[model samples]
Target: MLEEKFERLRNFLLAYFNQDMESPEGALQEYIEENSEGAISTTLAQINTFLHEDLTEQVKEQFIEDNCDLYFPALELTPVEWLKQVQAELKSTLG
Candidate 1:
């Protein structure tokens, strides 16, 4: 269940970043509001928790290695760090 949620969140972010969704930020805000009780920070914390605690190290590393470039450009940070940065950026942009 948690893995599915994380995948959904990741797909949302990818769509947002890739400009494949109209009003991606708005859509994400709506998603968070509906699914997470409008608590963006709490939702992000939950995502972070799932990333770090629920996934195995190898799985996490593979995911990061496979998709980091697609999401983050010209950055050498780990996947978790990139996620933190993206979350911060989104929060500021949405607010």
Candidate 2:
């Protein structure tokens, strides 16, 4: 269950980074409400760990390379920068 949630979070971030989301904040809020089990802190902590610790630099770079053709043309961010941006957005949105 945790792994599935983590995968969903990863996919959410991937879609966000790829600019495939029309309303990221709303979508994320819904997702949290649905999956957080009334513990937003635990959910956020798990997601933060996934974003900040589980996803290594090499994995991120490889993901970027593999999805190079799919990213938004105007997005000029490296993998680390993208992760940071996602983290910041998540924090701001949740708070």
Kindly give the stretch of ten consecutive residues in candidate 1 with the minimal lDDT sum: 64-73
- Candidate 2 displacement at residue 86 in angstroms: 1.8
Pairs in steric clash, model 1: none
lDDT of 2 by residue, 20-51 (tens): 54553454556555654435455456556655
* Clash-forming residue pairs, model 2: none
- Sum up the clashes in candidate 2: 0
Best by lDDT: 1
Q: What TM-score fits each model?
A: 0.47, 0.47
lDDT of 1 by residue, 1-95 (tens): 54465665555455444444344345555555555435566656655665667667667655544532243344566566666665675566447
Superposed Cα deviation of residue 14, candidate 2 (Å) = 5.6
- Residue 86 lDDT (model 2): 47
